[model samples]
Target: MASRVVRGGHALTEYLNAAKAAEPLYGDIQKHVLEAALRPSGRRQDVLHPSEMVKPDWCHLAAFHRLRLEVEPAEKRRTTFTRENIFQEGHETHTKWQRWLTEMGRLAGDWHCAVCDGYFWHDTTPAHCHECGAPSRCLTYAEVPLNAHPLRIGGTADGYSPQDAALIEIKTLGLGSLRYERPEYLERYTVPTDVGPVPDLTRLWRDFRRPLPSAVRQTQLYMYLASHFEDLPVDRTIFLYDFKSTQETKSFVVTYDESFSGPLIEAAAAIVDCVATDIAPRCNINSGSGCPSCLEFEEQK
Candidate 1:
């Protein structure tokens, strides 16, 4: 049988409707859970990551815990950070987009031409060094293997400090989805519609609810990637929760505390140690589960 997947603001509602028509028992269960979830505090506490609890180390080994995080489906979404938040229909191109980003950095950026200390402001758009005639470079993007969760881990190492990155991804979960479901929470939001230089477009945030499991998992995976690069700056790991919904987009910045990297580093190291020593601690109660990731040490003993 072919697997089926459906999504939208009314996806769950439609899903439950199908269930009610076909399987009343399971359908009622879904209704019960969803109704509770829609309550003021109906969230499932277990799903939320605890600040004190570091996730199981993701060694990407044959180990299951590590593998699950690596293999899990990620939200399919896309986001763009443009300087112009301005646009013209059928007028924008990636080159133009990059140029706009470069232009916006004129005053804020402390970078100078490598060969000659010329100002980028006066140079031609997509400026070349006036003194030495060198070209300006835009940020590079590299694709990651997780298609269920397409992500690009790219960063730049300028002279000032270590490398920093803009965590870009195809985001399917809108920012409005993560917010509380208040009466006024369902307001229309402004979104950019153009990726090229053609023109900027706008859309409304309709029917978007809490994030999908895949999207949040992808966010965590992005954080894990940050641990891979010990030199990755804290500011680089931060992401703008910009997920597009039918015709419109919802956006907000989701920045993490720089200190959070410490936990990720330690978790990464622990996973590495497990792999180096060939040990798989029980991930949960070992009731013939063949795992090692949970349970107190005494419980295991």
Candidate 2:
């Protein structure tokens, strides 16, 4: 037992020595990361994507600023590496699921012609581009562009399944969102219950769950645009939320409601109108309704 203790002590000392030797290296790497993150990303804010159409009041101002920036170049504010990393992770999650759906032959939607850049829904006969007569070999559905021309909103839907006649919108949610949405979730799941001392991670998802209001609005807008543009009669959306920690998923079938969606479109139209007139709307930053993009606009103004 004394020999064993001596060996353990030696191992601990080796680890401590190695960690001490690596301290400067780790510090250098962290400095580089922070510097890279702080560097202006130089990303263009040309169009206000559909996902960004959340705050109604800020929409017009944000859109107007984007248009103004097109004429006058400006440095865009850089987000923290943590927040940007989360976004990248969410994008990877969406890509993985979409790729899986494609591999499974479960994903459906219109085919985009690589040759002429035309879009046509999948049909019984051999698919071909209507505009340029490109064969099906030149068609793809990945990153399909969608536009609400009237509202001047554009974004790519995650996926679509003709079988269910529903559009898909995938979102990755971290524990922070759960804390905001259900503060009791962590406590209830991580604490010892009547069963045992170990945390019951399986019960993490409980009642009192609904899709984010912004997500619903975004999905509804997608459905409306898909139906109106493609004539696919898409009136429903499959809103899938993937938990980052557990890799578990919860889904909601969001049916499009004209009552809920109408005002959103109207709000988008107002933004477009504001942009057309080159008259910026009042800033909503003071009202606690602006996002990072809105804040950038406020700063630029």
Candidate 3:
């Protein structure tokens, strides 16, 4: 099937709609659980990792957990971290930042497909019209009648290799006390067979999770999907550059697999169904706190 992936504000709207629809069922529960999770202790004053400050979606968190599981064994056994481990750590931040930034950027027309011409919300103005080769100017939200659900798709490649028409994703991190002055760190880190090492996973994970940004993941996803669908060979690399200490940290290149999409598609489908039916699905995993909506419904009993 053609990818229905949307970008920018339209994606945010769909997510918000899903959240709103699920509110009665899962919103309050999620909020309450997050509140507790954020505050592991009774005191709410305790600070959290900067990345934790931004509430990441379940998919990003789950992906990170999966990545962690892949690496834990290596770390436990004192073996060199594999390419997969580094990739996961680099990806953890990418997923979190992409969602947060995309949502925020929607406020300023930052979200839209780079490939197509139509606005995600309204199909009237064509960014590029086929008939006259005339570019349809983007009308401000105020000027144009917009659709409740805008179509968001497409993204510009950051590190594109024009010669090969390949997109390269470089994931990086800033230098820290430990990583700094350690030449061996870069050698031990893994890279895709295409890209060279010099990119360390351990340090990348630390930085990636520290300050979350958005565009990174969106770009990666778009590139991955576009390459996959177009049957193009795209080079995706994550360069872990340590800005704090001014060092070129580590880099890795990775390819996507069917396993990655299985859960995401399932989650997206579930959310879409919930929005369509206005029915929140049950949480398969018991959170132990009990379902608030159900508890309230029972209180009336």
Candidate 4:
């Protein structure tokens, strides 16, 4: 039996189109959402983010240009509304899952007690505890900030569970298909284009068994930082991929591998050196690709 998956956007468009006929406020609501999408939020940190480091060769030149922009501010390209909406959706998905875990008492986050010189579990830091009283100083977890300050690298991991000795990372992916659907043998599945079936360049649906390389790298870095910063047994990570359309999930267990992060940190060091010396590294990508860094570097001269 051949597994069948269908793009979810088309069906959603049809339903939305029909619903708009009855909903008078739909246009206004959409306008509000679009405005929210366009609004820029959060100050950009110049440090190397785990998410940004997964690109080819760390896309070091682009990163260098970005860090430079912080000091020499300039107008930079903005991502499209569609892309922004995708990010917003991913954030919402993470919140939804984490909240569910907390509600079910399965999500345990670690907190440090300065007085006892120990760690405990709770959603947030408490003002006082039995051992630690009078303005208890503590560090709480969940979206816990982890960093290698000397290396200029930092990021927040999704969640941590002391009980399982595992770190949690949530990912949201577009519904590339109805995962449960299967087609009879010899039945048509995908549109036959002149080139071929829609290019599954990432093999997203055709081979959905494994996590994306970028996601794995991001998680590996988080695990590495968690183990070092908190002394937690972050030898393993649980990656939960939630499909946006159906909210269906697929989970994978990734064990810590020094082989994955050693090169990442090494790359970060190279980029840091380039920035410190005020010398731009040679572009790892072709200038013909219109890399912003290449253009910015040329303009700086």
Candidate 4 Cα deviation (angstroms), residue 6:
35
Candidate number with the higher lDDT (3 or 4): 4
Q: How well does candidate 2 match the true structure in TM-score terms?
A: 0.66
User: Per-prediction TM-score, please?
Assistant: 0.33, 0.66, 0.32, 0.66
Candidate 4: clashing residue pairs, number: 0
Q: What tens-digit string does per-residue lDDT give for candidate 3 at 207-256?
A: 44322233234334544444545344555433333333343344444433
Candidate topping lDDT:
2
* Candidate 4: residue 190 lDDT (0-100): 43
* Tens digit per residue, CA lDDT, model 1, 1-301: 8544434445455444646556687665555444433334432222212221333332222232332333222222221112112121112322333343445542112335655655442312335554566765532211222111112122221111122344433343333343433324333443245663221123233444434433444445444544444323333322222333333444333444445445544544554455446675444324454323332222323
Better structure of 2 and 3 per TM-score:
2
lDDT of each: 0.35, 0.65, 0.35, 0.64
* lDDT, candidate 2, 48-86, per-residue tens: 566766544444565677765663223433344355567
What is candidate 4's TM-score against the reference? Answer: 0.66
User: What range of 10 consecutive residues in model 1 has the weakest lDDT sum?
Assistant: 81-90
User: Clashing residue pairs, candidate 4?
Assistant: none
* After superposition, candidate 4 runs with Cα above 4 Å error: 1-24, 71-85, 104-142, 175-207, 287-290, 296-301
